[model samples]
Target: MSSHVAPDDQATSGLDRRGELREFLRSRRARLRPEDVGLPSYGRRRVPGLRREELAQLAGVSYAYYARLEQGYGETMSAEVLDAVARALRLSEEEREHLVRLAQPERQGTPQAAPPPQRLRPSVQHLLDGLGVPAYVVSRRLDILGWNRLAATVFGDWAQLTPEERNTARLIFLSPEARDRFADPERTALTAAGALRMNAGKSPEDSYLSSLIEELSQKSEEFRRLWARHEVSCGTVGDIVRMRHPLVGEFDLVHESMALRGGAPMRLVTYHAEPGSRSEEALRMLASWELEPRR
Candidate 1:
């Protein structure tokens, strides 16, 4: 049986894209000051953001067109115009890509229903087993599909949870144990939101993902607040992450997220502690625990 998207859902999605575009443009504009953009701070401006006219002038586009762009009607804006605007705004690569995705969402096309799960390859499992560090495979939706023993030892034994509960975002927002594992829950939660936003853009018609977001939003006011910000991050924010491990106390570890080759939508994330550090010692203990035979 073929799955299909309802027309009402499509309408709602259109509204969402437009609203997201409006907010993202407004937020980006608000951060830039006139002097920063080399524009004269002629008079005391009451509004916090760059004026539409100023942006239009910067991008070498007409005021009417730029105004429409800011109003979330940039669906027809040319690529060159968008590039100019992105340069004027000094947007990062990721931010620029996100702007394009929101403005020209139709060009990318949305799926009719949720995508099927991408299973981990046996090679990937072997690779994880050979690694010394903690590593796990996760889908774009943050589902912890598969994990090695070391990852299990450091992060909770996720094998205990159902497939739905195994999701990283769900755990971060809904599970007390997961929240407690983070050194700073608020920061991690925000990171989760950004990650989800990025993934959602690539697969907008994912009903399972949509349900996950609704559930999280309903369950967590914090999730709702962060999601409303509409920030999309292409990857992890930093090289290092601070995790509070219940077993070995606190850890400041570096992480690497590698996209699995061979057209898989999953990523393999590995956490490494600096050599000879307390965190490294903790990892050694974790490895030892992994080696212990289960009853």
Candidate 2:
């Protein structure tokens, strides 16, 4: 069957939602084994993971129906049906939401103008400035919309970068300094790519977002590999993030992200170190450098 773009997406941004849906489902299915889902293994399989028919049986749907959906032709699929399929695939919360978005673009209501230029609210800016720790605001697309002085000091002066250069995915994948700054570049890059994938599902018709993904795919082999995994995540639990800063040497900080209310999809991300710790001391010293007179 020939694949087609969703009507809303085509009219707004011409993104290939059908292709995305197919790939996402395939990737999710690929990660599971027959035994993983309480299915008895039979003869040797030609492809990896559960066959389309097996998955259909698990979801209590017809084989042809599931195959059509996999091929990107089930726009009318009910939420109940999708939910059952999600359960059959053992998808995560974020992944299930992503599936619905991809499978039913029309339900997303009126599309925005390919995402207008996101501006940071003054109150949010004030909130970032008031925080002693490194803090910044990021759009759903992972664009660094605004950051505080301490954040600039810790994460490198994003002010020096072009708007496009300030994106988290771009910084992690394409920037050399990012590889050096991150203690685990591979994990960081994967996280960034996964977040990007999540946003892609949310706003598939955003041209700028599509361009960013294409750019990274072309320039970064690592990004290409991670993007193919089709993982979806909005946030991870608080964990110590080690940074190898050129000026501060090295330090660890715990990261937290909160969604900003009454605005476009944006997150307030902050990094803080434990009190009375060596990392805290390093952060204090780093903050003072920003206030020191230029020599």
- In order, the Cα lDDT scores of the candidates are 0.75, 0.79
Q: Can you write out model 1's per-residue Cα lDDT over 1-295, one digit (the tens) per residue? A: 0011222122223235666677778777888888888898777888786887888899999999988887889889998999999998888887888788778876656534335666677888889888988888888778886888887777787877877688888898888887887788887788788787767666666767777776776677788777766667744634677788767889887878878766548888888999999989988977887443221
True lDDT of residue 148, candidate 1: 82
What is candidate 2's lDDT per residue for 27-104, written digit by digit as tens? 888888999999998999888999888899999999988988998876878888999999999998888888888898
Cα displacement (angstroms), candidate 1, residue 287, comes to 1.5
Measured over all alpha carbons after superposition, the RMSD of each candidate to the real structure, in angstroms, is: 4.8, 4.6
Q: Give TM-scores for every candidate, taking all chains together and pairing residue i with residue i.
A: 0.86, 0.88
Residue 8 shift from truth in candidate 1, angstroms: 17
Candidate 1: which pairs clash?
none
- Model 2 scores worst on lDDT over the 10 consecutive residues at 1-10
Best by lDDT: 2
Q: Relative to the unseen true structure, what is the C-alpha lDDT of residue 208 in candidate 2, on a scale of 0 to 100?
A: 77
